[model samples]
Target: MSTHSYDAIVVGARCAGAPIAMLLARAGANVLLVDKATFPSDTMSTHLVHPPGVAALRRWGLLERLEQTGCPAVERYSFDFGPVTIAGTPRPIDGAARAYCPRRTVLDALLVAAAVEAGAELREGFTVEEVVADGGRVTGIRGHARHGSSVTEHAPLVVGADGRHSAVVKAVRPGQYDERPSRTAMYYAYWSELPVDGFETGIRGERHRGWAAARTHDGLTVMPFGWPIEEFHANRHDIEGHFLAMMDLAGDLGERVRAATRESRFVGTSELPGYFRTPYGPGWALAGDAGYHKNPITAMGINDAFRDAELVAGAVADALSGTRPLDDGLRDYQRIRDEEVRPIYELTDAFARLDPPPPEMQRLIGAMHGNQEAMDAFVSVQASTLPAPELFSPDNVARIMREAGADG
Candidate 1:
């Protein structure tokens, strides 16, 4: 077997891995980024990146590249809860008030190019066969390119950005906490000639159904419909039928969608499980869905991946550059990551259940209707630019109720 060495090795070169490798190489670290899939490949994703994620791209100097791809910026978010539709703009985060739903083929390639440009070595189509360890410390990886002989690469650090079913995670056997079973199943398709003004989400509380639509690259719209996990089996057999029927619950969206042409096959999953894994060990670390995963109902996957990429990259750089101990740096990364995502994790778990909102939440949503400020705050909460607690605080909720002339 061939042997090589680097300062760090990153697995799964998509959203999380590419950014982590890019940032580390930018920090002057010798990094190796490997992925089983070649660039421009599509993956299943909600594809929505909120304002904070947009800010991350801007910081990385890739926002303009994304814009040049003809992906539309979603400046408004509308939540249709059957009885009331609350539409408003989320508050800006770092001068980014808009979201984008770029196709994964475009976005992931952009990221991989950035990583390569930053001097990270890329091994496309490399599949990891083993995460090698020595004395309980991750030492390197054994993998090979498609149609090639297996080779070994050693590094002080091995990072897994390999998604929920991470090979590295399986090898390291990191402890997981707050584990929950799948709560919802979702299916989506891309359609041509179906234009949406911005991001639109609909909830049919009575039917325990939800759907969302957003305009993406090539002027196509991507729409997803979801149901409780209990119904996943029944619905999987007739995805088109159930999808169209759910769209019918969203007013005229069904009519508009019917008038459009489907440009892609239906894609979906019912395996979403909410949990956070212990992200770091002696010489290994996790980033993105490899460490934390939750339902895509809130559309937070891409955004959170961007955020954690920066965090893990910074942590690894600090450690490798002798700014701190590796364990300390990774520990800090774990703590901060957990603290940052706990709120949204809880919110996503609850929403994924497709249960009707509690009386208080229903009342709060009702009070926000027709009230621009309150609705904006609500949207901000959904975008994760503002904390949910801030908007749902007793004082804020009461003030909104009073201003909207709704009974408390």
Candidate 2:
């Protein structure tokens, strides 16, 4: 048994946790980032970075490092909305740009390494048992080390950056977190020895083939589909086979998938949602996906996580400097994160409702799908920065409403 305390203790060390821990550590706070999994582990994601997300990385100095790590620059983002293929510049707003494609495995590992370098103590392969609270305030966490040895760590602040199903979140914000499912499941993998057509220019193979990036990582193509869970479960394995079938359906995409010498294991995930609203209490705060786990319909995971890390870092930095109260700093963290995600989630949730194509949303997508500049901004709206009205701007959206014969 061991007992120790710090200024802050962050739970979960993967995508969300690691980055937040790194940010606070670099600011000179004693931080510990705990994860149940080891580094370089496989994570499920479409792995496409959005414009604002990429910009956030550049601010954190991770963009330069990612480019140095075989990450490709992405200049084009096209969407095959099952009706039309909307192709546009990679940025949503003007002067916005980001790198093309990088696998989550590599991206996450890079962030973790950066966190370690910044002086964060990472405790992997450890299971969190409970959160320690003092008079209605969270003060520490109880984690079981690998050998089942019990360890307790105290901290004035405890951060929950632990991804979607965060254990720390469960311990802290059980009632404050509310989320609505996006009704979409994702399946992804990698391939080599296959030359993908229309994808040779991008990063790896292709992404968002159905609705995401074309090629990213080392010739790896990721595909995601929006299907009702109960219905999708009936043909889950068949769905994986269907994904392979599509890659083989197109001549270039087909030939590449068929001839690949290296193939990554196929993975599937369901319940990717647009759950926001975190619980920020005294001496405790939520970060990353824990704070605002948005719908992945736009593939905003990596960049969103990076942005959250920065948000938390700035807040923690302020608290450490005695310029901010811990609770006040946390509420600031919550407010900023919520504000950033609200607009994007609005667009994403509205986009997901296209099965019946609600009149207004139908008009929106129909109007902008043809304009490349509009399309870039369209994607930007789903990216967590551009306001929702920007997408529905009278001038920007006038074309569609005109086509629908709705004037004035």
Q: For each of the candidates, give the backbone clash count.
A: 0, 16
TM-scores for every candidate against the unseen true structure:
0.98, 0.85
Model 2 TM-score?
A: 0.85
Point out where model 2 deviates above 4 Å.
1-3, 92-96, 193-210, 244-262, 353-356, 359-370, 382-385, 399-408
lDDT of each: 0.90, 0.66
Screening candidate 1 with a backbone cut-off below 3 angstroms (N, C-alpha, C), the clashing residue pairs are: none
By TM-score, how accurate is candidate 1?
A: 0.98
lDDT of 1 by residue, 1-408 (tens): 545669999999988999999999999999999999999889988699999999999999999999999989999999998889899999998999999999999999999999999999999999999999999999999998999998889998999999988999999999999998998888889999997868999888779999999999887899987999899888888998888888778787778898999998889999999999999998899999999999999999888889889988998888877898878878888898888888888888888888788888898888889999988998898888998878878888889989978864
Best by lDDT: 1
Candidate 1 residue runs with Cα over 4 Å from true position: 1-3
